[model samples]
Target chain A: MQILDRFRDPETGRALLARVSALAEQAQEKLGRRVVFMEVCGTHTVAISKAGLRSLLDGKLELRSGPGCPVCVTDYGDIDAMVAFGRLPGVTVGTFGDMVRVPGSQTSLEQEKARGADIRVFYSPADAVKWAEANPDREMVFLGVGFETTAPAIALSVAQARALGLKNYSVFLANKVVPPALHALLVDPELRLDGFILPGHVSAIIGRRAYDFIAEEYGLPSVISGFETLDILDALYNLLRQVLAGEARVENGYTRVVKEAGNLRAQALLDQFFEITDVSWRGFGVIPGSGLQWKPEYRDFDARVRFAPEVAEPRIPKGCRCGDLLKGKLTPRECKLFATACTPTHPVGPCMVSTEGACAAFYQYERRSS
Target chain B: MPTGNKSEDVILLAHGDGGRLTHELVTGLFLRHFENRLLRELTDAAAFPVGEGRMAVTTDSFVIDPPFFPGGDIGKLAVCGTVNDLAVSGAEPRYLTVAFLIEEGFPLADLDRVVASMAQACQEAGVQVVAGDTKVVGRGHLDKIFINTTGVGLIRPDVDLGYHRLAPGDLILVNGNMGDHGMAVLAAREGFGFADQVVSDCVALHRITGRLLDELGRGVRLMRDLTRGGLATSAKEIAVSAGMDIWLSESEIPIGLAVQGAAEMLGVDPLYLANEGKFLAVVAPTEVEKALTLLRADELGREARIIGEVKAGGGNVFLKTALGGTKYLDLLAGAPLPRIC
Candidate 1:
């Protein structure tokens, strides 16, 4: 607790903020407009709003949230398939808490659960395996939804099931990788130019060198940051300093956990069971080699191969700007249905439903800032 | 065999059939702990005399998972929850009626412990359990047990606390830390492995509310027990009802180290978590110091502070962050969910 409290010290945060302001002022004058930077992690979006960092740098810099929340970017077709799995008799769908409320083409897992369907929330995929072992008659389908930080754990759960010879256990893989999505965003000619604040947890797995392309190919200053008030402030200070010095490079601000090469053991676990494939994003269309799926040897454990539930075509919720919001093209307030037609209670989009989504975090913490 | 000591018995469906087992359970377990003159009469109703003043009545049900946790249990939570509701209205809690809906096959030892806890809490609060009922359902029909408590109290003649009395410049103060009860219950239920460190603050708050009303009668504008919605929801509701904005200082609000750590790991906001023993009092600016001094002298209000103020605005609540930026506070849309990313 003392170690965590050290990172939240107000005095240290204030010192870093003063330096950020001085550097931000220099960068703004040089750019001839407010310097823009985007945080590409959902947790970073929430921390920035919770700490009021954006408003502190009000006129000197503009902060935008990108496509970082895994739940927000999950294609509607994927949700449709997962929800359909719950409709099958004698089948149980286990997933993280955020996935239950996300609306699919027809209904959500929460709705299906109320109609006598089996849907349970598990903190980890390994718990789902335990549940499957306890209830041998039920077919357990674990929805794998997350990025690099979570992929290794899900892969390990699959491995555990095989080692135990669990015939009733399978995984609905909806996992996406981050770097390819970043490459897709960079190629979009409609979006503007800016630096990036990378995800700390993801970088702890993929490592810092994985993002070298952002500096080498796109020439943007990006810093991998931890999720704390001071960490964010320090990241902003480093980002502004890079802009002021006219240098673009990938820097690791979260050196405590993230190394040059991430956890090799975890990467080896991921590589053991899965292969790269093209995945469809909710807002952005299909990007090449952006998702992970079961390899040939592990195909028998895939939920789609086991259940083969019929899924309808994906349908987008009308008037929802989650797509635009995910790409950092528009703010949540700019949407027509922001507070009037859509809110947290009756969210019309996944961006408002997910806790770490851009719209939900902004609405919860900083809706009154402007 | 109906042993004289039925403490080791498991409750059966016959326990609720108005048979010999029902009578024995009432006389042996409930009556022994909740002994009082009114309940001893064994009448159909509890009749008592009241003075020529207004009275308050409130009811709440407890179905919290695990039923028991560190610092308190569901039995204590039921009594304190209802007592605080009545106390916040400037009423002196006097009587309570408890009812139980228990699952068949529940252990009698566990039932006795729960009833004993309730009896002890009522004894400390100086209230009597004058009436009660018990029903046993089939196995799997209900979770282990559920408790419902209805409280009756007499309103203080001189106390006048209401939203109508609220105005700009009123100061808001809470009794102690936020999010302790919530994080404690969460740790116990989820086994996230910090149950020993964070204990629930499930104590009655009448002593603090009683002192505030007795001393600063007109100065106390409004009082609310922070329960299911915690401080943020209560403040937002008060703001809407009083037609004034509530501005809270993030740095001034007190939070325990264990609670902060648990919330960080779970990715939930402490402001929206539930509290069993915490309440907020809106006092006029003139009596801020006197009110704080009176509150700090009490054990429950030891960590009290002026966390926010009422302002003239369009009925909204805002929190000024530790970094000097403002954020709006609204009712939580849905229950806080743990994040995977």
Candidate 2:
């Protein structure tokens, strides 16, 4: 009635948490086994860590961070290529912030900048076209990076860039689709996850049907959680109840935004300029057909096979815990140099560099209590 | 010598691009509103240091749509944002690590130019990038390039900053205005051009912060850079965490005329807007003058002033408006502006 203001719903959040916590406890007893739920969204990792919600959970139920952090999963070779490419003459690279802090073999984008490289962080994929139109001399590259949630926009941008006939522009796509990554995580013996807190934002586009594979094939339970604390708790509670009932299915806890089929228009937009292909994830290694590559029809914007990035697998630094951190095997504090040498200031690995990284989430939010 | 005139039709990918377009976008449409010496350096890196001490490090990843806008582009904002987070925590920014998440087919030239902007920012802030990484997703998998900067700064011995330090009667002081960054970004992203420019107030606060630390010392109780949640949310957090009441004069809160106008037009509250470069420092009333003096002497804090004070018993945040009305600034439970906002 009052537009559902949070100011008015203050107690609702508290009440929701209490109710869900009680339900979770009951479900925990009913399920009869120790259950672990993984939040696959980078935002969920941050929200969970920052709110100290993980520590608040009772012993029976555990929350794990997944590969939802796009920044944390980007490989070392790719980071070097982006920085090295940014250093190229007559080129300008536009990108998001998560890619800026990953450790490369020789230099990072920050180091490349020190050596006079031009690496710009764009808020959107379309911004590159804006820059291209304004300056007709230099070629512009949108260093596209993210999962399906952000992939559609870049697709639209590539379409727009092509339609506009801006020959001085292209995209260095680092896009990963969610379904394969989810499938990969399920098969990963290293990850013994019991349930999943699906990303609400991603679900809104990919639809609830996207996760049906996880439930039907793997028998893993899932609940789409929002960014809010109460929403997340509620999602956990639903997931726990599902497990207690011996059920495996996808349930949407965030009914406020996400729909069963997802944003149709956005899906169509993605279908226009990009196609799913097997791609590489830095920490998880290569996933067969887990990425979105430029459609050959739009090869003009394709840089790797087109421009031939000076890409090489740069050897990671010795003792960096980035690999283990991304797999959820180790916390940021578990890294050899986490606090001693690797800090938000002096990060030793890509995990520490990314704010969305499990290591960064652990260091920023969890380690204070640890 | 000009490609085209500045107009607010739409922002393209090239604006985040480091080519001639980016230069024109900044100089033509954005820089004039919030010009200063630090911003004028126009280098690819910024560098600064702490004499000697144990260091604390922090890094943040940034992704915003329509990268180039009224106040600042993603490049400048990224560098300043990383630096300020370290600065407010009483850290001397020494080194930074950056990574890139690039899309397939992205032009290499643009990457080089943005790197130059990042280098310029680092040089202005007196910090260096020691290491980094990069990765490429398929064409449809990402927006463009995502930059994550991991910064390391040395912590000073005299200052021990955490959430615990707060006492009744402590005064609250903010450098310059609120909501400028949020409003400017929003205006440009939404294509809402204004007669008067509403540029982002993004800058590295460490310069002024260092001066305050040197001048006021332990007299400063607590300090934090209010970003996405703005002053209201951060103050509420402090009040609830410290178990103290925060009372303030809404009139005393500084707001650029254009920022206030934009907020009013968009039906957004200035208190809830994000700030990239500003800070909220809790100072004892007695030390307020010294803090103000130190802040004002620095170009970044030229508009510094005392706006509020800490109180006991309330455990809530209330403000006295210019019209003498009391209003509670509550947290916006939902996303206010959606993605890139």
Q: Say which candidate scores most in DockQ.
A: 1
Q: After best superposition, candidate 1 residue B217: deviation in angstroms? A: 2.3
- Encode model 1's per-residue lDDT on B1-341: one tens digit a residue: 24354544788898889899999999999999999999999899999998757899999999999898988998999899999999998899999999999988888988999999999999988899999999999988999899999999998677888999998899999989999998889888877778899999999988889989888979998899998878898998998888889999999998998899889887889999899899999999999999999989999989999999999987788998877867888888877888886
Which parts of model 2 have CA positions greater than 4 angstroms off?
A1-4, A27-34, A58-60, B2-341
Q: Pick the candidate with the highest lDDT.
A: 1
- CAPRI-style grade of the A/B interface in model 1: medium
The per-prediction i-RMS, to one decimal, reads 2.3, 12.6
B174 Cα displacement, candidate 2 (Å): 7.5
| Cα error of candidate 2 at position B136, Å | 42
Worst-scoring 10-residue span by lDDT in model 1 chain A: A361-370
Q: Model 1: number of clashes?
A: 0
> Tens digit of lDDT per residue, candidate 2, span A286-320?
89988888878888788776578677767878888
| Candidate 1 error regions (>4 Å) | B1-8
lDDT of 1: 0.90
Q: What are the RMSDs of all candidates, in order?
A: 2.5, 14.3
